[model samples]
Target: MTDAELDLVFKALADPTRRRIIERLDDHPGQTLFEVCAATLAEDGSGLSRQTISQHLDILERAGLVRTARKGRTKIHTADLSPLRLVAGCWLGRFIQED
Candidate 1:
């Protein structure tokens, strides 16, 4: 990933809610907005509305950390591990290995 992509990824993960969303997605590969909202609400019981979850998904999608697709009436969201893997392999990996 380029510097800007890394910046976006970090920025997206900076929010606690977004991070939780990522974790949830990691556990549940393909989840709809309702499923994600239910999971979030179950964890905290604060009840995140669909709109709020949508916004979080938007941020993740923009950062290239997540992907969205329409499935009939619901929109399915899935985690994209490529960016994280890229960063880990290129940026973080470089630090641990000798030149």
Candidate 2:
């Protein structure tokens, strides 16, 4: 990934909500919007709306961290780990040694 592309991925991960969303997808791939909305609800049952979650999904999709497939009336999201692995192998991996 280019610098700008990496920047985009980092930016998408910068948000707390987005981070939780990613975590949700990582644990349970192919989750519908409603499922994600329910899983992220706070203790008091107040959390992000469907619209807000959708927006975050869009940003994540654009950053190549996630992908969506429409099945009937629902959309299933799957985590794409390639970009993150790339960042680890090509960028962050340089910082550590096998020692």
Candidate 3:
């Protein structure tokens, strides 16, 4: 990933809500906006608005952390960890040595 793309990935993960959203999508892929909202509420009792979650989803999508697809009339979201794995392997992995 380019510096800008890495920046976007880091930025997207910088937020607590976005991280939680990523966690949600990771555990359960292909969830609609409403299902995401419901799961978030059920998990933490957070009263986050749908619009707020939608905005977070947008950020994740831009960072290549989340992917969205149309399921009939609804849009379902899934987590894509390639960028994260790339970052970990290419950037962070350099810091550690195999024993």
Note the Cα lDDT for every prediction shown: 0.87, 0.85, 0.92
Judge candidate 2 against the unseen true structure and give its global Cα lDDT, from 0 to 1: 0.85
The residue ranges of model 2 lying beyond 4 angstroms of the native Cα positions read 42-46
Model 3 residue 73 CA deviation (Å) reads 1.1
Candidate 2 local Cα displacement, residue 62, angstroms: 0.6
Quick one: ranking by TM-score, best first?
A: 3, 2, 1
Model 2 TM: 0.85
Model number with the top TM-score:
3
Give candidate 3's TM-score: 0.92
Error of 3 at 50 (Å): 0.8
In each prediction, how many residue pairs overlap at the backbone (N, C-alpha, C within less than 3 A)?
0, 0, 0
Tens digit of per-residue lDDT, candidate 2, span 14-86? 9988888888799899998888888888532656778998899999999999999998988899888788888
The TM-score measured for candidate 1 stands at 0.82
Residue 43 C-alpha lDDT in model 3: 88
lDDT digits (tens) for residues 21-97 of candidate 3: 99989999999999999998998799999999999999999999999999999999999999999888777777864
Candidate 3 — what's its lDDT? Answer: 0.92
- Worst window of 10 by summed lDDT in candidate 2: 40-49
Per-prediction TM-score: 0.82, 0.85, 0.92
